[model samples]
Target chain A: MSKIIVQGVAQGTVLKTTSPINFLGAVDKKTGVIHDKKYDIFEKSVKDTVLVFPHGIGSSVGAYTIYSLKSNQSAPVAMICQKADLTVASGCALANIPMIVVSNEEFNSIQDGNQITIDTKSEKIFN
Target chain B: MELTSEENAALNGEHGDTLQTAYRILVATGEATNAEKLIPIKWAHLSGVNYNTIGDAGEQFLRELSKDARVKVKATVNPMGIDFDHISEFNHIDDEFIKKQASIRDSYIRMGVEPTFSCTPYDIFDLPEKNTQVSFAESNAAIFANSLGGLKTNKESAFSALASAITGKSPYSDLRKDDITTPMTIRMKMDNPNELDFGMLGFFAGKVGDTSVNISGVSQPNRRSCKALCGGMGTSGTCAKFQFIDSEDEKSEKVDFGKEEMNEVFDELNTAEKGDIITLGSPQLGLEELSDLSKMLKGKSFEKRCLIFCSRAVQEQARTLDYINEIERAGGEILSDCCTCLTPLIDTNETDAVTTNSIKGAYYLNNSTGVNVNLKPLTKIIEDETK
Candidate 1:
């Protein structure tokens, strides 16, 4: 069963990474592109996709960066994580973006470019 | 997470949009962290004040929130782009930067947050009672409060702390919980480590360790050195809440911090053999460091430009103690209400490299500001750069 962190329903292509994100340094706020070369999905745009990652890492400004993405209209339609950290959770809540968490088994089952739907009210994430 | 009737009401938008937003954030954070309920916090020290860090998006966010949100508890802010009192001194800051920075300040003030634009809040402000929960967004302050000041916090983000300030509550999880234990232990193999050495050790520890680190083999470090450790740890990685242990059990996973590890960090940060200018205070120098610097430079003057960053209160207090005068007499510029990290004062085009005693400052200057850093100890900097 998938756990919903933020309440919303959205469908988008999956942009998955095994690496934990630090939104403050990893993502470009204006372009919604992953800038950190260390990550698996480097230089890929996060716009209007399902941002799937392990979790978030980094300092306090990271939350604001996530909000910046939404403000700039470059935000992911929804986010799915194997775990939820404070930075991503707070940002997702503040930005009013849908967020969900899935088990490790389920996380590995999803792949990049897959069309996924996140329905928080129903607590379901399906392709 | 279970919420009280008042919290539920706020979440339901009965208390206005600001409270509704705050409660929603808190509830989400609590649910994610597996916190059973939201606990009231004594204070919140936020860090989104830097215009360079937040840009227009964060400024707009605060501007909108300021219309209705007011801090329920004591809330302190971090440093902005330029020190408003000393605005005319720095040529790098433009009118637009000043205007946006001012807007950010106005928003915080309108929300009833204190204009204490200092990173070392634990140094200047009167601390709350021991074990009291607080929300701190400044990384160094959070680490210092947790490890040394006997206060508890989870090293909150700017948004999380702002939300906590508005609601007077934080999710009781991670470092806030009493049952938390140190997952990694580091044993030092260095002999008589200086402040910079300790900072290197801390930077290494933050990189390798987990949520909490247990460090052994350091005996009673001074205040400035302790601050350096916190600052360096806060700078390099996400590990928080380090404790000094005299001894440890055999079952614990241990890491060693030695000469090789120290050299690796030093080599990584200290890219320049010499620098055009010297900059200090990533955590912002407190009164103790100022006093030490004043004593060190009693009969000497810096051969090159030396910029010292400290809090306004600390700077004023140092002036009263004759420390600021001595530093200024030695050709050091005392920049208050701001530190070296992400400040616009240090222009990379004019100065290709910067010499700094703070490891945290070195990292940010090299990575964010695009300047080569010359990392040195305070004593070495004074010895080599002054005549």
Candidate 2:
């Protein structure tokens, strides 16, 4: 089951990366490019897509990096994580980005390029 | 999460854009953390002041927020990129860096935040009552406030602390809750350990524990060692509070930290055989540390360049006590409102490595500043480096 951590409506194609994201190092704030070659989604753009990752791993400064992305018009439409840590939760709140938490099974089931819709009121994810 | 009528009004945009934004952040954080409601806080110590850390996006955000928002509670900030007073003394800081740094500070000041850029606000500012709730973003200060100051706070992020400052409210969860249970214990097997040893033990405990940990071994540590332990633990992991294991709580799950484990951590952080310069004060030294340093370096001078970081408040007190003259006589340059971690003052072209007692300093200097570290204790540094 996927729970809504931050309530909102977002529908878009998923950009799933199995590796956890550190907003400070893993993504570019200006271009929204996933430049961390260690991850599977290298060279991918997070703009306008539903970004999915395991969780955030980095300094608290990563929260500002997320807000910077939103200000620069390079932010994701929504975020899906297996767990919502303080860093990501605060960043999503600051940027007004919708955040959803899903089970490990559901996270693995959602593949890159998969299309989906999120509605926090009904607490459902439709594919 | 259930919010009070005032909180609801703030979220409903009845208050203003600033409060609406602040409440939105609070409610979202509360919902995420399973907090029941919002609780008022006495203070908020924020981070993200360093331009090198926050970048252009953060600067722009602050500039916009400063226009309409003022802190609802007492607020203080973390260190910026450079010591604004000593800009001409360092080679690494340029005009662009200074301009950006000034803008960040200005934004905070315009929002009614105090320009106390020290990370150790507990040393400089008048602390709130014991058990009173606050929000702190600096990791070391958060650890110290919870463990030593008897205050309640979660390890808040920069944005979360800023939100709390604007709203004077924090989510009632984590360390703020009164129902916190006794945590796992890490027993240190060393007898008569110094500050560096305590630092190693703290780093080990923070790595192993979750939210809180119990440490047993060192008893009645002075202020300097306590600060070192807090700095080391803050650098290692997310562990917030450390407690001494009470004699009645011997049945808890216990881990051991001995010489072997200490050497392992030392080997991990100590990457250099020697340092080009000696640096101190990762958490920024207080009056106590300054007095000790002064006594150690009474007539002797450093053989190489030595940079000491401290807060202007403590530095003034140390000057009144004649500690600053002794330090300066020993060829130590005292920089205020900044510390060794992530400061642009230490240019890689000027020096390759730093020798310090702080585990936090060693970690960041090596990882972020592209330098090596010789992790020696204060006693060892004074013995070998001073003549």
Candidate 3:
């Protein structure tokens, strides 16, 4: 019922990630390795901040990576995108994670490592 | 946002069962792009190899879907793979790729999709005529169809593309190709120029341009660079609809789209720094390409670590020759079937950094693998080996 503050809400279990295709969002659903190799959003770049960005950037194989993490039960609890491309969409669907897409500006408004919450049904984002 | 008559009818059970399945898929894409109505489609290129791999679950699902619905187009070719001992054009392929390749191929065949087995599907068949609406997959091929051939296709999924082809229409929206007027202008440049360096330049150009670029100023480049740029840009900006312009052609239609103008149009979403993993052969390779690499890599050793990958379809041939032996011997591992853009076959933590000559390879590696990738020329890779 509230919007997660860009800098303040960069915490809480990361239910959603908006990382662009370049800066990969990490969700080790298996061992719960929330740290990603793509750019260390949780570990270095944002340091476990609420992660947000555009849709995934790299391979459709991003689908498999998502699957691996999700199957291992280490994936983020939810996800939202400016647009849900195949890689993340497939993974979200397969893993049964809540995913939605909003405007790019709204995506940018989010800061790293902020505690975040999401309303998947309403497509409203909270930080 | 409202559904078109076709989409509305499908949702309301006006269309047949097949149309309904197609409708579900189209509606998902339509909602994403914020399209108002759906239009019928004539052809498509599929994405997603299978609903399930290693088992008949996918085959059964597709077989059931095929029973109720049929594609609308004259021909629909899914992304390519191999079932047997065929061409081996990829690089650094791993073991047991053939089994996975065959599993997916079996699923596609069961779902009634033709196994064209080439990333460049236009080579085998003519694209739907200019402005002929079709569903397509993969960013690079979509760009090639839109800009190079003038055929119209939105970056769609295997399901949506399949739905459009079956229903013979797609949802007409503001995002439709016909809706786009002129391509956006750019002013990007590569720091230095050399042979085989075109790949990296194209990649960066695509990234810089973001969706919908009319770029110029890629001087003295080649065909691979053009494709690489288109492909890489597609990766960076999923909705990128672009045309690499003829920079030197004063009378040409190609416009400028590059790094200089990137700040104007795009919001730098997430950034990467210098030097990372070196990847090759993202979208499956053919046998000849892999064979050539095997020859080039003969007796070569890497001073730095690199990940060499090949598509599973082409890897079959390489495996026959035991190509990985050369890579393992040369201090690198050959990944099969999987491309770096999707996910690292191995974990990213095991490696320090990366570098490569492929723009597509670099973009995926940089973004998906979390490795800062430096795209270099094949010649440079060779030089490093000799050193």
TM-score for chain B considered on its own, for each of the candidates: 0.97, 0.97, 0.65
What is the Cα-based lDDT of residue B127 in candidate 1?
A: 87
Q: Which stretches of candidate 3 lie over 4 Å from their true place?
A: A1-18, A21-35, A43-52, A60-78, A82-99, A102-127, B1-6, B12-21, B50-70, B74-101, B181-184, B191-196, B246-356, B363-375, B379-387
User: What is each predicted model's overall lDDT from 0 to 1?
Assistant: 0.87, 0.85, 0.52
Interface RMSD of each: 1.7, 2.4, 6.8
Task: Give the deviation of candidate 3 from the true structure as CA RMSD.
Answer: 8.1
Query: What are the clashing pairs of model 1?
Result: none
Model 1 whole-model lDDT (C-alpha atoms):
0.87
Off by over 4 Å in 1: A34-42
Q: How does model 2 score on DockQ?
A: 0.44
Q: Over the stretch B100-119, how does candidate 2's per-residue lDDT look in tens digits?
A: 88899999999998888888
Candidate 3's clash total is 74
- How should the candidates be ordered by lDDT, best one leading? 1, 2, 3
Residue-by-residue lDDT tens digits, candidate 3, B274-368: 34345565544445555666677787777665656554444555778876666667766565434455442434565445555555655445444
Per-residue lDDT over B141-246 for candidate 1, one digit per residue giving the tens place of the 0 to 100 score? 9999999989999878787898899889999888999888787889988988888988898888877776689999999999888999998887666677999999
